[model samples]
Target: MSKEEQAMKGLWDMFKKRMWLDSFRMKESLMAYNPSEIHCIAYIGEDMDSNVTKLAESFDMTRGAISKLTKKLINKGLIESYQRADNKKEVYFKLTSQGKKIYNIHEDIHREFKDRDQPFFNQVTEEQLDVILDFANKYNTHLDAEIMKLGIKMRSDNL
Candidate 1:
């Protein structure tokens, strides 16, 4: 309602829009795989302890959904499942050579993105960068708390 409130609201809206647009562009660039599948691949590539449960938890998705994605990735020859010698009942996923290629491409894209933004970042003062980082950290912490609250509410509702 006030000028300051309106300005802050506008800034937040624009920031959200920019992020959505950037995500859309990235999705378009990685047309071979959908965002979820690429994310799963990247996660498996990075974390040796990755499993369906871990992937689901990391992505805030259902195990069933992650299982379906893993199945699709397997069908595409991007990932393979193996059982740990210590735990025969549990299955884990690892990226195949093909999956590694996709992961590399994703990494390259991110690297290029950062490189492209480096000039602007280089111009930002340390104080300004710190302010941005602090804002981001606080915003993410708030979102995590909200997600936990929603999870509790959902579990209670299901009872």
Candidate 2:
């Protein structure tokens, strides 16, 4: 293999492993739920007043599962649900005070890790950081477009 190919493979491997480890660490910190569920909680906590249906779609989960999870959160006093002003059938959810506290705890945990790593990254030159940031954004855009196309093709095939 070419040197470039080997470098790309090493980068991909490191990225994948880091993502897995991060997920595991996040879940360990949250204690009660897995990474995906905690992600849903964090997103909902931040979004404020998003409905179960919208969240389910965002997480690619079934409405029933979202409903169940919402109920669990409500029972834990982490979230509250109410009917939307425009539509009685639409239920909106927002984090309770306790939920916000938990969210803050999660945020602090992440900030601690980020701060710890910041000094290490500070050695990277400004030009290098700019190039890396630009390339990351470009790659994300390209990947998103390709994923959307694949999703559409898959849906058409299913039909």
Candidate 1 stretches greater than 4 Å from native: 1-28, 140-159
lDDT tens digits, residues 84-155, model 1?
A: 999999999999999999999888877876887789889999999899789779887986798788876333
TM-score of each: 0.79, 0.73
Instruction: Report the C-alpha lDDT of model 2 over 1-159, residue by residue, as the tens digit.
Output: 999699679879978876776666676777776555566668887786689878877777778888988888888888889886789988998888988877887788788768867897889898988998897898889877987888753221142
Candidate 2 — what's its lDDT?
0.77
Model 2 worst lDDT run, 10 consecutive residues: 150-159
Task: Tell me how candidate 1 scores on lDDT.
Answer: 0.85
Model 2 earns a TM-score of: 0.73
lDDT of 2 at 124: 89
